[model samples]
Target: MRRVLDLAWLALLVFMAATWQFMPDLVGAPQQAMPRDQHMAVMLAVAVFGVWLTTRGALLVARLAPGLVNLPCRDHWLAPERREQTLADLGDRLAVLGLGLVLLFAGLHYRALQAAQPSWPQVPDIAWTAGGVALGLIFALWLLALMRRFGRLAPVTTPRPVRRSSRSRDLVWREVQPVWPLLVVLLPIGVGVGLGLFFRKADDHEAWLLTALPLLLTAALGRMVTEVHGDRLTWRFGWLPWPRWQVDLDEIVTAEPARSRWIEGWGIHVTSDGRLYNASGTQAVRLTLRDGRRLRLGTGEPRELLQLLKSRIAGD
Candidate 1:
């Protein structure tokens, strides 16, 4: 859904370049209606699809979960302490974006309606031209602003990090190799195949949806990664926006490897000991925090991750 809608908008912007070749009138005022489907598609794409970033990029499940909002620097803004504000702002941004969408479609819709009659004052082609651009900008800017604000935010408890050489900085980074539990990965594929077989006659969108679900799930569950940078630790299901987390390096009191029980299962779970961030398999490194909070960080390379933690904390 997100990809298709974005492609729809991309088509108009890319085609808008044709103003030089054909619709040159697009640039100036007395700004005329984009005669064909260009304007219509922009409005539809932005209004229908630009609902403050789907996959908030359309919640690709972003609104469904803010921690996993698909930002590489998610740890900075989506920290547990500030999460509520994020949800509130996300709601507000979407509400305002809704208004913008209303105006956007209204202008484009009016232009379409008036395209036939010359006497109808041309609705300034701004709607067809800059409307979508502005709305999309709003989406991008909101997130950029969020990341900007939080990235610079001084932690109340954590101390600031000092400068380090490139080599030393690299030492602080570790990849918690993600693995696919064969059964978990195959379950979706199996379901999708059964659905396809059952619904062999399903239409294009339905078929796409059926096929897409397993593929998406497979991708989301396929990889897990963890990293430490700038005195912060971050991790995610490789390539996904949710089911990820970050922590200030200063918060940790100790780090060590632990064996996850079969009963613990996988994914994010709150156990009696602490919250668990598991990708797959039984291997994980448990971190004891200054606040006495515990986290079982799932990793394929526990030694490297443990070393990375030591390097970061020791400021090596």
Candidate 2:
């Protein structure tokens, strides 16, 4: 059943790509009648609905053929360590798959550009480019959902310690330096800026791409700080006045030390089953919320931070 579903998904992806690539021919002349924003919104809605329906159909098939969809590791999700390992392995596999797809698309894009006629319409080029990006994002999200459905059934564990809430204290503050290795993210931004400057006279797209580089650089270089005040726990990056993330301490269901691989990278990101906010080291703390959402904060002093949070939660 799993293999069948996988093949079906692959076929669907191919179909979508082909449809997008040949849209100009299939739909006749391009229509710039609709505003770009409106057109993009409609396309996005259609893509989203298509993914949701495909996922729903896959689930229905699994329900109808439960015997075929059963996991090889029957009790794997029951063990915390095993579950984590399984998720991490899946993440690594997905990352490799994403990289390969990106490379494949890049090769195809290069070939298309090379074979293009001097007078070829730009509308088809834009359509094909947008379609490729949309397909990549949708496929990645679908794979993530598939993995989560397979592995996110682990039982909840006990919460870790947090510092006690003291009425006399206005706040509890803790800050750790982000991992130095995360700084490497700046390398790509530098390259992007250099290329953009070199091609400044070429197109408006280069200017737009350049304008976004600073924001990415800021996010990549931002520090992670955790602040606990009153009933709120806030996580912020850099000197940003507004918190990048915050949660009501009351909503926290569990907290524990969690490990991540270097490949997981840093900064705010979503996993198949949780959200990660890491700036540095692989060692961090994971928080499970009352609503089943998970958040991870990368920290160098995992034990100390965990104990403080545990005590705080107990005190509260």
Candidate 3:
């Protein structure tokens, strides 16, 4: 039943994206536009072609450069059963929240449309568009929930060893050239500010939402802090500490110095091969976990950090 609902939701999204090219017309805006059906067909074709190309390219690259591709794993550092339970719990909550929000928004949109105009013709189009948006949001929330529940569930063959001694070594690396990560963090804020300026005349309620974008983005990506304490490797944004991820030394199969491209940028991102938690510098240490999942942590001194981790793992 859940899978069927998910597929239906995805189909609705494809339909909406296809017809997005005619959104102005659907919203009753005054403009000369292409025929709605014809425009939708073109857009649908383009979107499908783009997705196909991207998937094909990714697969080809994965085959050619296996090192670049990180095998998917159930657990990053947490025990497999525990991670699964955590995800299932979180997914249930998010699924309920998403469904409720969709219903609430759909009702509000319908009410607004009815109140604005006592009309027949535009109602269907407007309702359809609004419902599509609501469905898209619900789908996104549900998808995220599912990914969280399943994405990190790898079997924990190597259990994290309990440290008997409180004594632990710490290795910290500051970005020698911090400008890029700084710019990466600020770019979104700049764009948000630009949008706010362009829409200065927007309603007060909408303006408040627009104003919050930069602050939210800054909190999410502002400053990257990477630290290794004992057998645990963790990284978090300087502004927000609650959402940090960690890697247990026991799970690490190997740690080696590696280089990242500028295109990879800086942030917590899931790459083709594995998950990356990076802040600044091209220098990084890639840790291949026992489950085959890879984690690349950016640092100014990749070689030193890599050696430190390996030595610690050996000592353990």
Candidate 4:
């Protein structure tokens, strides 16, 4: 349903672009003179896409569970001191966005007065442009500060060891050796970005480069699929692919996290339950054992994968 809605929105944007191109004189004012129809079409399409992307990005941020929403018998692992720090960091970043919008609106009337004669009255001058650019940089820096604070919170999730017995138990213990799916996907994109940046003219290059950034990131993520082996969890990126996590199979109790196509969003996400793993806009399955622990992994073949893991653990 979300996919269908997204496609419909894109189609509407395309239709609007076509209308703008064929009806530029109708859209732009008489004084400014019509931009070339082709150029206008491209610009309009880009603008629509940019706005859609920005809106979607904000939604993704909002979906986050916020402030250590999960505690799986591992509260001891959490950074006791960093909780307040994380909240403070979030408040500061949110303030930056708030202040930016306030300034943007407050200056709008002044900017409009200056551009009254000009057809595009909304456009600001070089000084205002510079100020806008500065605000953007400050916003990015504030976001980075928040990310660093979040990183500090992550180390607190270190796994704890558990006691095990030789008695048979219904368990599903499998490890991802190397994550190579992402590197394979990203290599082409990085190459494309590099070529466009170097071969194209400056004017065309920047536009193409700007457009390529998201594609490049998506490709990188596509390359980041995991490989399940025995006891180790591996994360790969190109030649640098290797194991980043090597948790003992016994250390992993039931690792079930809630994952439903109905609820999970795109890309790899660790849910508030600490049991669900969603890597894309795809299928989901739950894992359970005789013990209380549970694990959920979103895979293309969830049923088959679950069976395989059960069999593997049974053999172990």
Best by lDDT: 1
Q: Name the TM-score of candidate 3.
A: 0.48
**Global lDDT scores for all candidate models:** 0.60, 0.56, 0.55, 0.44
- Single out the weakest 10-residue window by summed lDDT for candidate 1: 19-28
Model 2 has a clash total of 13
Instruction: Give the per-residue Cα lDDT of candidate 1 at 84.
Output: 62
**For model 4, how does the per-residue alpha-carbon lDDT over 177-237 read when each residue is reduced to its tens digit?**
2233444555466666656755764455454555576554543444334444454322332
Candidate ranking (lDDT, best to worst): 1, 2, 3, 4
Winner by TM-score? 3
C-alpha displacement of 81 in model 4, angstroms? 17
**What's the TM-score of every candidate structure?**
0.44, 0.47, 0.48, 0.35
Each model's backbone clash number: 11, 13, 6, 17
Clash pairs, model 3 backbone? 69-273, 70-273, 74-152, 74-153, 74-154, 75-154
- Tens digit of per-residue lDDT, candidate 3, span 1-316: 2232234335544545543442433332347445545545554554444433333344454444534533334234234444444443443344344334334433433443444345312345577677778777766755564465356654565655655465355654333324354456565666676567557754543455456665566665666676676757777765655466677766677898887777887776556545566777677788887655577887877766777678777764
Q: Please, what are the lDDT tens digits per residue for candidate 2 over residues 15-34?
A: 44543443232221245344
List the candidate 1 regions with Cα displacement exceeding 4 Å: 1-172, 182-199, 203-206, 241-243
Error of 4 at 51 (Å): 31
Error of 4 at 128 (Å): 14
